[model samples]
Target: MNTPARSRITAVLPAHNEVGALPATIASLRAQTIPPDRIIVVSDRSTDHTVEIAEAFGVEAMETVDNAARKAGALNQALEILEPEGFVLIMDADTQIVPRFIERALQEFQDPDVGGVGAVFRADPPTGYLELCQYLEWARYAEQIERTGKTFVMSGTAALIRWQALKDVESRFGSIYDEQTITEDMRLTMTLRACGWQVRSPVECQSTTETMPNVPTLWRQRRRWYLGALQNITEMGWNRVTRRYIGQQVMLALSVILMTTLIGLTVASYAVNGFLGVQPFWLVIGAVFAAERVVTVWDQPWPRRLFAALVIPELIYALILQSAYVGAVWQKLNSSQGEWAHLGTPHKTTEEV
Candidate 1:
């Protein structure tokens, strides 16, 4: 009896002016337990030394030709150039995976129906309050993914995808990625599932990603993310694969509305009565909610867990995210194009992992 042949893995990192983060990212890829057979850095008009650094690491590096679609365009270019027999890893330039991430993520591919495996991402050491909030938020998301065994998007941060699945999408849709949508990862997720493929985000696959350092950058990052998700859902339309996605969006909108209404009523009541009104039943519910937050982030550092227990700061963070959702809705209604906010590279003074 002949043994089954193992599939070769190719990793494609899409970068734009990522000189500061490229070296560490490349090093992480080299250290993977099941390292990629080939590493390709797709440069999107990077003026910095991103290409030079990639070459220094002895990996294949290529530049995109007249590509204006950002990461998706660069990925499409890479997809067109290569014919891989197995899997392709689409990873952001800013993300660094654990040594065993590829090995573990690849395990999910044992079942032929699996189309993609996404990373459970953690923020790189946060330097500020906002970054810390993002870190906790990522932790909560990882916990949810672990519990549910469902994936909304094989995060653009890093995802291991089957080459055959990409081919299936192209055969049906004419292109592997819809460049028209800003969130190609979400669009691809919807497309793959629609075509009878399953996407998973297992707990064993983990990575660390950079966080926005300031308010403006965070706002832009989230606004673009929210807007991209909404746009992708609209473009995919209603189908068995997309119905859940649309439902998730509906739930999120309802959550925003509920939060706003609760806050408005609280404020109105306080204004009407000179002394603050307190409801014992609502306080009990709020305590349970805070306890749930703390439980979700219990694996994180004590500071973060304490922060979640406090609840107010996270409440503010929730409001910030909800505001970004509203902003995305406005952009969608106005048909405004979302702008990519290429985050600034970390300071040279910071030690690379």
Candidate 2:
């Protein structure tokens, strides 16, 4: 019997003022069961000690002058400098990979048809109340990924991509990471599929990442995400008649629109009932929806499950922000370009783990 060959993996970390998160992230990479051949951390105009921290880890640290395209631009800048030879694993500075994350992710690419693979992501443990709420939401995402091999989007926290597949798409689409789009991960995955490649989420690979730990931060983060989703749909041109990718994009857009509209209508009904002395059925409906969400995640542990049960409040918040973002996206689809506000910055600066 012959043993299988090992895969060559290169990990890329795109950093911008991530001094505090850099140490833990680097340590996580160092602690990998099957270590990467090379770890590259691209410092995108950091005003902090991000590059210094990366160098301290004995990893390759490269600094770039421009921070124009945000995370996607940072990633593409890294790609430009690094030679394209093997699998590229792109991760955020705040994300910590599990011991076997890379080892397992590489295994999926052994199947040539798989162009990219996403890992099961969980929020870092011992988080705050709001963070726990975010964790439960991610848990639902993890469940869906496990059930369906097809993932609608690949998380930037931890994703493995075949170099050849990336090159193929980049050659046609101009750049693997689109600087114009806010949700580069979704855009790249969609582009890959458009060019005849399959993207999957593997069950084995897992990564732990930080989540917004407060209501205000979570609101801003989700709003930007919703806005980005709208931009991606328009940029890709949501056409059900032409391609399945377009159809999928359209469905995703409509779902967002529908959910936002439903939430807005429910809220409006509650206000109207209070003003006109009408029945408060909408409030009752909202309560029922909240109860249903709580019931769905009842199997989790005490506090965790309790937190999950209170998802309605979070959902309501998300819907309101998403509705506003959708309107903003509609108005600025042609020229909406901005840096994603770093929500975990406070935690990153204060917390040490």
Which candidate tops TM-score? 1
Candidate 1 residue spans exceeding 4 A from truth: 1-5, 345-353
Per-candidate RMSD, Å: 3.0, 4.5
Top candidate on lDDT is 1
Pairing residues by index, what is the TM-score of model 1?
A: 0.95
Candidate 1 overall lDDT versus native: 0.84
Per-residue alpha-carbon lDDT of candidate 2 for residues 1-353, written as tens digits (9 for 90 to 100):
11135756899998777787888888888889888889999888777788888888798999876557777788888888777777888988878888888777767766777788877788876456566666777777777677666587877778988888889888998988998887788788788887777777776777887776566666656656656666777677755312554564466568787886765876887798764343589668767877766665565677766655566656664565555556556546556553466544654542111
Q: Ten residues in a row with the worst lDDT in model 1?
A: 344-353
- Residue 4 displacement (Å), model 2: 8.1
Give each model a TM-score. Answer: 0.95, 0.82
Q: lDDT (0-100) at residue 175 of candidate 2?
A: 89
Task: Give the per-residue Cα lDDT of candidate 1 at 28.
Answer: 91
